[model samples]
Target: MIGLDPWSPQAPDDPGLTALLEDARAAAGDPVAALALADRATERLPLPGTGRTAELWRGLAELAAVDLTVARTLEPHLDAVAILAQAADAGYAVPPASGTWGVYAAEGPGARLEARPGDEGRLVLSGRKPWCSLAEHVDSALVTAWVDDERRILVAVDLSHPGVELVDEPWVARGLPRVRSTGLRLTDVPGVPVGDPGWYLTRPGFAWGGLGVAACWLGGAMGLTRRMRTAATEREPDQIGLSLLGKADMALTAAAAVLTEASSAVDAGLVEGEHAWPRCVRVRSVVHDACETVLTAAAHALGPGPLTGEEEHAARVADLQLYLRQHKAERDAALVGQAVADGMPVAWA
Candidate 1:
């Protein structure tokens, strides 16, 4: 009910971003090229928050806007791994932006990275860490390891070093082959400690970074609206189609507004102050639901026709669907609701 234009005439844009998107798109056609280009563009991006770096990066992402969570996850200045480096430097006197980087923190029966002490008291990680996005390609990575049953350690590792082995052809996601994320086995991979422990999640940037992800989701939802509109317009005029288009339009319009306001907050250091967590939870959940609405409306409106018949449209939907799942889902929903009920400062007022 509280919304403005569906699309901002001047959200954020750059000349270089146009070239970067072009290169990125061309590179996306090849897995190897895509990996290299992501790093290249990341390095080329000015440091975050410098000259509207964050806003422009998110805007450029909307240009390609094919719902590619993989490339979006790996490439650009907003990358989690890259942001980790920035956080490390700002919080712990570490350099975050010398080269390409990744964050591999997932753990499980199949995705375990064990940490042990070395003779000099440095951290050494061994075992297999699954979900290492672009692990084989990135120059370095920020990894989380089990220090004990109840503790975890964050370490920075040079991926090219010995004892680090990328499992052969580990990724097979049909929607995001360009991301190249997969399981990797680390056998005594030496690493430098990032923080005392819990630094990764405790930092204010953690929540800010989570909001960055929501920006991507919102951008993708808006991008998908183009196809949704085309799908509705090409068909015989029907109430159902019109309704679906309206739902998709409103959902994306709401998402865009939230993202714009959230981005303004981030730029103003509001997210960096006391409101980080609740603000993050609220924006992520809201944008996540909006994206779902768009996806559903677009699907039901188009029926099985575009999903099965058209390759590009189908690929975008599949990619966005998979990418959207990265959000915490119902857990996040409950947590955000609780925050609001408890009166956290998630509202601008």
Candidate 2:
């Protein structure tokens, strides 16, 4: 609510933040500018579900309107704020703030964090964390590691410490290349336990945070969809072209409506109930499917010229494809399906 647009030309808290936003807005392939923007976003990160749900969603949309890669890259750090808040609410002692934080709990084969507790509440984290976004750039991160054979614990790590290495080799995806997401190899990295065992994934806000990601995907898709709409209006289009445009418009409009409605529901404290996770899943699936349709229709309507020739449009499409992979699509849809099968009302207002 502070700024109407995330990428507007309004004065930021500082001149450096303004420059950072401008450079990030211009960054299509330049990862450095995007990194600077990521750093600036750290200063005033909001703790999610603290009644800023709608504002965070809108900010993601505005950022997506500029560069989806930058938006995707910065979103995890924002998610970290929410995760930290959840841990604190769960009665876990988070590490003292040094700088911005990220949530990197995604694991791959042979990935596990070993937590060795030291005297005076210090802990050393070692092992491989396979999927960390903004691993190298972020100052700290809330990492997940095996506390026991049965459960995982959340550790707040100072990424600037010695023996913390970011392995970019595994992050070979070109779609979100500017995001700098990679594997973290920690060799006795110092940290502090954030939450009790199994708090990170079990928290209610986890799914709600996932919805925030879907919001970004929706925003990116709408940005790309608008290009097709603009093209359809600018040129004298045939019926087929107009038909594709219409389809794209419908998908984008419906998705936006769902997002707005969800925002209102969130503001009304509707997401605090037992069905919150399922509801979040439903919203995410809707927006995700809508975004896929928008991307397809935009490509078919605008043709390959915008994709291969235009700089910004192509990047948006590519970034969206990569960003949407954050969630298990089919499985997410199946959750909603199962909920409906269990006689759970969707409250489809």
lDDT (Cα atoms) of all candidates against the true structure: 0.66, 0.73
Cα displacement (Å) at residue 18, model 2 = 9.7
User: Can you write out model 2's per-residue Cα lDDT over 124-215, one digit (the tens) per residue?
Assistant: 88899987776766788888888778788888888888889987665567687667668889998887887777766667677778877877
Which residue pairs collide in model 1, if any?
A: none
TM-score of each: 0.83, 0.86
**Global CA lDDT of candidate 2, please?**
0.73
Clashes of each: 0, 0
Q: Best-fitting candidate, measured by lDDT?
A: 2
Candidate 1 structure, TM-score to reference = 0.83
Error of 1 at 17 (Å): 0.6
**lDDT, candidate 1, 1-349, per-residue tens:** 1125442224234666566566655654354565555554564554444435455436434533633543564443345454555656666644455566777777767566778987555788898887777676678887889888777878878889888887865456766556666777889888877776776666666776666566667666666677767765676758887888788778767776776676666666666644577677877888889989988887787778877898667877777787787888888878777877777764455
